[model samples]
Target: MRRSRTGRRAGAALALTALTVPLTVAFSTTASATAASSCYAVRGPYQKQAEKFLGLRVDGRQSASDCRAIRAFQTSHGITPNIGYAGPVTWGVMRVVAQQQAAGHQPNRAHKCPTDRGRIACVDLTRQISWVQDGSKLVYGPVPVRTGRNGYETRTGAKRIYWRHLHHVSTLYHVAMPYSQFFDGGQAFHSISGSVWSAPGSHGCVNMRGKDAKKYWSLLKNGDDVYVYGRKPGT
Candidate 1:
């Protein structure tokens, strides 16, 4: 599922500088020479592998070599000194760079954050569907969702959900999904046991704990800031 996400690059911003540690270089890219398309704007196979294997995916039209070049760029930009140089950190940084460039904030980098204001309220990476928070109150959700495996994760920054759920039952609240995926889509998040960060993992969607599922279901109301997003898109 393609995601509309944005945030200040962790290390690219002052966050890392304040800590006196350089940003970690963790991604390499290979873009096709045909165009200057941004990685975030292009989603391809590497994006799939990056998300699945590294908990982060590549965007834009970068080739494997472009991915590698991205790593070199980060290294030159003082991202991090001689480490992996190509991983989730790179994706996170690129998000910042892409948005910043698009917003005309920086020359080639990004500073603006991304969000799904009109996009889907929730997304199921494995299921490839965005969830409706409260089709009635929120005027957006109350839709369907396929959360993570264990039900213990939801990314931060994409959406800020402040509302709570009553009757706290994902299954009862959003009747669009089945019994299996409905395990507890309430507030819990998703993430596979091992790594690979592939489609199998939580993919940065909201996982739910069975116990808290029904509780949140019975508690959430309208106009809540469902602050979502912690992982990157493609993760």
Candidate 2:
């Protein structure tokens, strides 16, 4: 009877151990999955500035799409290990670039832009701003812009707007180039999202705000002078 009691106790202990081990493993697995699914969220003061720059809603909330956009921008600008998180490095780059643009300093002091000034679109690459002038008189802008990145620099010097498309889509990149006015080969001035101001750059085009782009489309016609001067900052 004593032996049987001992045996029964051992069997119960074994069964309990078997059940507890699986339960512990299961709990650990669940905890790991939850942690993995949770992504880092962007917030604080820089969030507003980043949103404005990226052309996203100025709301201070960071969404999944925001992370994705941030990742895309990081990838384009050659930020390593594009993990889609807006950490210190990302925010620092944006602040520096924005400050440079706000300074409105031109790189080409000697280039007087002495061509057909009757109606011209002048792009100051250093300032990252565009303006429409009618014979030295400013018609529109000093508006913010995003030019091409390092490798695909926007061609500097004199050019002419050869084509105009109100609703143009790029065949190469397949992205929309709204209110596009092609000045250089496969390069144009068009409207892009505010997010564009964040980082990376257009392929070879001058990206303007949506409102500014529409204004340019209305103000300038095809075959107008498009003078691009200065080097884009950090290029």
Candidate 3:
């Protein structure tokens, strides 16, 4: 009876092992695909996000301003548009991204900024902004910025110098662009629109004093990593 019971126990264990093996393989395979898809999304985009990057109505008509807005944003981020920078890859991602707030998702490994070694430079661009000190170093820059309309929210993230215009110009603010260095998402480190002590302003780009902006502009280049944190310029 004891020998029979031992054989039955061994058979039950073997059956359980058979069921688990496929599950483990499936899970790992799925994880690998998800990672691959994410990289392709950021590097290329699908169709939906492309529209948002272009600032167009995903299914609606594309206006002249939409074209201009998209151009300006990309320029600030230091990206020379792709043929037109209007790739289908970007559009698909934007379509999936809701303008309204959703459950928070963490940054994928791709977005982390390099500090010191990885970062040859840093700046906090906002219209009428202030500087942050990490030790004796001025780790944060006082950036003048423009912000979104009623519901648009400026973002904070691991950033890098996307594009650097040695001597650039701006049309919206009716003056030469300050700092003129673009960071993530078409935002830049530039001069503030006006003189002020404190206010919540900007459509979500950094602002600066023309002279100070020029100083900041002199220090950066494309791909030098940094982080853009806190509010849009002056909070």
Local distance difference test values of all predictions, in order: 0.36, 0.76, 0.47
Which ten-residue region of model 2 has the weakest summed lDDT? 103-112
Ranking by lDDT: 2, 3, 1
Against the true structure, candidate 3 reaches a TM-score of: 0.38
lDDT of 1 by residue, 146-193 (tens): 334343344444443444433333344343211122222344332222
> What is candidate 2's local distance difference test score?
0.76
Tens-place lDDT digits, model 3, residues 99-128:
211212212122223334433433332322
Error of 2 at 211 (Å): 0.6
Cα miss at 140, model 1 (Å)?
Answer: 5.5
Choose 1 or 2, whichever is better by TM-score: 2
Pairwise TM-score winner, candidates 1 and 3 = 3
Cα lDDT, model 3, residue 140: 38
Candidate 2 residues lying further than 4 Å off, grouped into runs, are 1-111
Report residue 93 deviation for candidate 1 (angstroms).
Answer: 15
lDDT of 2 by residue, 1-235 (tens): 3578889999999999999999999999999887644555756446666677788887878888776677676666555445556666677566656655564544223445543468888887776777777765667766778899899999998899999999999999988889999999999988875555656778889998789899999998888998888787668
Q: Decide which is better by lDDT, 2 or 3.
A: 2
Best lDDT goes to which candidate?
Answer: 2
